[model samples]
Target: MSSLISTPIAPTSHTLLKPNRNTLLRGDSLLPKRLSCTRTRSSSTTRALLSTTKESVLKDFHERRALKIISGLQNLNKENVASVVTAADKGGATHVDIACDPDLVKLATSLTSLPVCVSSVDPAAFSAAVEAGALMVEIGNYDSFYEMGIVFSPEQILNLTKETKRILPSMTLSVTVPHTLSLPDQIKLAEQLEQEGVDIIQTEGGKGSSPSKPGVLGLIEKATPTLAAAYAISRAVKIPVMCSSGLSAVTAPMAITAGASGVGVGSAVNKLNDGVAMIAEVRSIADSLSLSTGRHIVSEKNTLRL
Candidate 1:
């Protein structure tokens, strides 16, 4: 009887109160608006930085004397990579190409302000490297693979280019036309790549050449295939053409004269065991390009005067 003192306690109001629509709307309007503004500013800043970087990276190419020093796509030796980067920086190179690794990009950026380009055949691998500060990504430099008897077909290269563009639509992309193909096929591939929005086409033929002689004549013989590819593909496409492989101080300027907007030198500079020699090689190539560009400008001016 004592426990039944159920004087009907007024039914406790157990109903949970819901937030008012107006109150919820006001709450959402506050912090979210500030976050949106912040995101917009950050996006705008990133775009501006990218534009400036691209402009600076392409400055020398537009001037038709871009000297890109490559350290090899498979060369991961940090010490060698560092030496190559240092040589390129000190040798007045406009760009540097290294393997597609975020750490390598960081290392190169730390060593020099030159636009660092990462090389990879895997399209997916470029994202992290680009995020790490690589201003350009290349899809060729297949010499090491060629040594292993591996080669990329035209369809394979096209698909890779498509995928890369999908992933990094705004990035500067350079694709190489495989030297295994006939020269006509190379020009065809170059035209196809240009149609796919490729910013540059790089020609390679060093792995295919076995010079039969020595000295300057041998150098010319070594560079003939790539120079031919450059001359043909440059005429077939509207974008910049980078003539690479088996080139030296003797033939780098010849590449520019063959309608290449730029020249990429690798073994000539990277093969040297001495860093001083590496730097000297890069300087020689750079000087050769400068002299070639100067002569071209003078020739144009004289033509105008005439």
Candidate 2:
């Protein structure tokens, strides 16, 4: 009788231990499920935060009077970059664009409150700059490349836009339609980019124009291609069109009149050797945009009264 009781008791103890092991395994499996849920929620929260940031940064664009000052896509000089950024901030410009460098982004951000935009042809390069504090990324800036006889086709630009959107879906993206393309193709590309979720379509034509006259008429002639592009693309798509390249205070308001939501001045401000001159140029463009906006408002009011 004692042997029988002992053997059964040992077997019962083994059964109890086996159930405890199974219970531990089940709890461990549930931990992974809980962790996955936590990760998903964290990702959702992060996307929401980025979306909010994008909206706040683009407020000026939504107002149809954004003045962007470009520090040149190829410009890597920190001193020059600092001067341009300071000019944009003090000169009443709404945004500043610089080369896509993390260090430069940090420098620009440190110098001004205006939203810093980083320009790069490499889609992979934009992430670090954005992480460093850039609020926007531009894919065009094809002027330097054009000088090298390099040009981007419509397919290439579209692919770049798609890749950039894939990499940073929540960040504000501005795609510049190459001035090398015909006006119809430019419009087509702009429409496609808007479908791809691009926030802004920038038109560039500085390199293509050869102004015969050397003054204000020359400026208008220089801006003609970009202005036409802005007008066509703005009407073609609901997205904002930014007229860039070969733009100055004289032609900046003309850009607004021609249907551009904003203007981007690069060589006009970046080409100046003096910081005060850069600021003055930016202020001139900003004042032009301001006056244009004022005139537009009054025109609308008067029309309403009529």
Top candidate, metric TM-score: 2
Give the winner by lDDT: 1
Query: Any idea what lDDT model 1 has?
Result: 0.86
Q: How accurate is candidate 2 locally (lDDT)?
A: 0.85
Q: Which stretches of model 1 miss by more than 4 angstroms?
A: 1-45, 291-306
| Stretches of candidate 2 exceeding 4 Å from the true structure | 1-41, 291-306
Q: For model 2, how does the per-residue alpha-carbon lDDT over 1-306 read when each residue is reduced to its tens digit?
A: 111111111122221123445443454355577776776788699889888988877877888889999998999999999999999998888899999999999999999988999998877777788879998999978788777677787777877788787777778999999998899999999999999999999999988999999999999999999999998898999988999999999999888888888899999988899999998888888887784456568799999999
TM-score of each: 0.82, 0.83
What is candidate 2's TM-score against the reference? 0.83
